[model samples]
Target: MDDPVTFARKLRREQTLPERRFWGLVRPWREAGLHWRRQAPIGPYVVDFVCKARNLIVEIDGDTHYSEAGLAHDESRTAYLAERGHRVLRFTNSEVTQGGEGVYTVLMGVLGEPGAER
Candidate 1:
């Protein structure tokens, strides 16, 4: 398995729009109580973002994710994480970019509190 730091570096080199938005918000959230790992591998997949402190995974999907096949793939990924005792939260690219406050709210809810200590 790749180390989290190395994975994060790789992700930075290949940054995407959704990743930038998610990481923008994730930084503050990490300081509050959550620690997120980018491109963190789990089982046979590399999750978008993972907060092991909370056993949570956050996925940001792009337009291509609207396809039927993409949805099915996401469902399977979520199920895999669930089976591994992790909670998965998914958001679209637009949602994270245009709905920053809403995204933060949802993430806070999942993380338990705005100032939750893990």
Candidate 2:
């Protein structure tokens, strides 16, 4: 990808099955004012999802992401984003495809209603 914005757009267009599933679950919450952007760019990386208001970035890790090099890269990326005061959340592809219950639980735990059940 030439630029982060362009890359993000491409990611949005070419979403994986897990990505599509996760997005479908969250889109309605976004419409209700918990704003979110799919395939958003922050600095040099393109995150799977971002909530600017919350300074949160969410990434969906596929099998390749478990490789040594990928793990190192993800660590650096997380550190870089953290340096800029952003929180990163990661979910595995299977976790998403399997129903995204854990993903939702974490998200809500981080950004849910004040009195909502955990």
lDDT of each: 0.81, 0.85
lDDT of 2 at 65: 91
Q: Per-residue CA lDDT of candidate 1, range 61-107, in tens?
A: 88877899988988887898999999888888888888578888997
Identify the candidate with maximal TM-score.
2
lDDT of 2 at 60: 90
Evaluated against the true structure, the overall lDDT of model 1 is: 0.81
Query: What is the RMSD, in Å, between candidate 1 and the native fold over all Cα?
Result: 3.1
Q: Residue 78, candidate 2: how far off, in angstroms?
A: 0.3
Candidate 2 ranges beyond 4 A from true positions: 114-118
